[model samples]
Target: MAVALDIVHDTQETYRKVLTSMSRPGTISTVIGDMDNPFPCHYATFLTILTLLDREVYFHVISDGENLSKVITDYTLAQETSIENADFIIVPNGTNEEAVIDAMQKCKVGTLEDPQNSSTWIIEQNMISVTGTITLTGPGIKHTTSLHLDITAELLEMRNRRVQEFPLGIDLIFTDPVSLACIPRTTKVSLDGGVI
Candidate 1:
């Protein structure tokens, strides 16, 4: 069908954008898709989900409403999994700090032998600002880069705890309405100039 072909093309394009952002680490990449939107989730979030989730993987949607569950399953056919077992986790915008904290706390960090089994977070933010207070330093960055999160300090604190140990933490991809950025576990995220 023409509709299916178009979806395939859009998803491929979104995958390229996500890949570029992931490889660059601190830099932002725009996901410009003209795909039809039917869910309550943000446009960027919808695109990210289409690119990352499928029947081969399991995902959990936290900090979002129930409507997203049906939408995600219908489109991606990815299993709706529990937080601890999710290969991918999504946190939609307008979610309270506590819910995000809870999801972060429960997400799997992977095992020693199979670190690739870890969960990846697709988080929707109100906006990924041009300038930020958080400093990032690691594999993909040249020296250090800054990112400002629109969420509360409590959520940041929780995320800080998640990535403390290498090969044993979650990876995060943050999306706004039009753009996305990645923070893989290898990157060190520090608040201000100090490591949290």
Candidate 2:
């Protein structure tokens, strides 16, 4: 039992580091956990699944394949659920704007009393940059900050729509090969819409 507790603690620590990295944007972080797989999912994704998933958590995989589902189930011991019922939604790549927005609409809002029960969406980006002209504001920002992303305009529109829900919409974590960025529902984003 002691060993099990230690493992859980370690997992939580790893996740905390990852979350901190994401919250800061353009930052790189490493995830040291118990994942033994050598293929497909990256270390960050593996750590995320290990930390956030369990028997009580339901995850939706939008990447399209049994391999992802198998990997998630084997690593996290989480149940597979549809978009409407998922507590966490993972998109291995961040290109599916329509699907992501549709899934977001289906996620539970958890009411005003328990907003933490709401769903979180994880999307993997090809790369993350700190040079884009877009600015972000809200809880995580001291004032406003700029970030560059390889995101589509359609996705930004969807995010804007989601932002209108304020504290009730799904939060986003965008991961790249070695870094991550988070845009919580509370964030207000403004895009330059310029060519990059």
Candidate 3:
């Protein structure tokens, strides 16, 4: 069984965690609640969307199974749109590399004057495995902080290219059942080895 999030309190906490996590890039923040989602995606991902989405924003979900796009639309009353037009893009872990790259390419990156208008990506992963190392630095880091992540080279390359435009890139939030982390556009990410 699953319990609905306490809209008022849980959202407030989740919002705080998101803010704190983004401010301290690479740090994991615990998500406060869960929902009864039959999808393979994480509950925290659903919770995050519930807390953030509104009828005014457009959202898109990329899932191999489950009609998450329809579910989110019905729940939030937010329009279910194409990735290119969505304000938020949600994807499950291990989505096809080509599809992920295509989505990344098509999504809005915002303009220099209105960078905050860019899309936010919610990537659902089961665990933060230590297959490879990445060093993050920028607004949140004291000097530089390192983390182990199981992300693909192609995905990282896309992010690298996007962030090259500076304030015109999309922001990302990685979530699991219990915790979440972020990689804001302003953060600098460097891979330890050649690629992973």
Per lDDT, the best of the predicted structures is: 1
By TM-score, the best candidate is: 1
Residue 192 in model 1: lDDT: 76
lDDT of 1: 0.82
Q: Which window of ten consecutive residues has the lowest lDDT sum in model 1?
A: 1-10
Q: Lowest-lDDT window of 10 residues in candidate 3? A: 32-41
Once superposed on the true structure, which residue ranges of model 1 sit more than 4 Å away at CA?
Answer: 1-5, 33-36
lDDT of 1 by residue, 1-196 (tens): 1123257777888899888878878778877645455568877788789888889999888855657978899988999989999999888887776877998998899888988898999888888865988888888899998887676667777877887777788888999877899988888877778867
TM-score of every candidate relative to the true structure = 0.91, 0.79, 0.89
Residue pairs that clash (backbone atoms under 3 angstroms), model 3? none
Clashing pairs in 1: 132-148
Residue 142 of model 2 has an lDDT of 72
RMSD of every prediction: 2.9, 5.0, 2.5
Q: Which tens-of-lDDT digit does each residue in 21-89 have in candidate 3?
A: 899998888784445755456777877887899899998877546777777877789998888899999
Model 3 backbone overlap count: 0
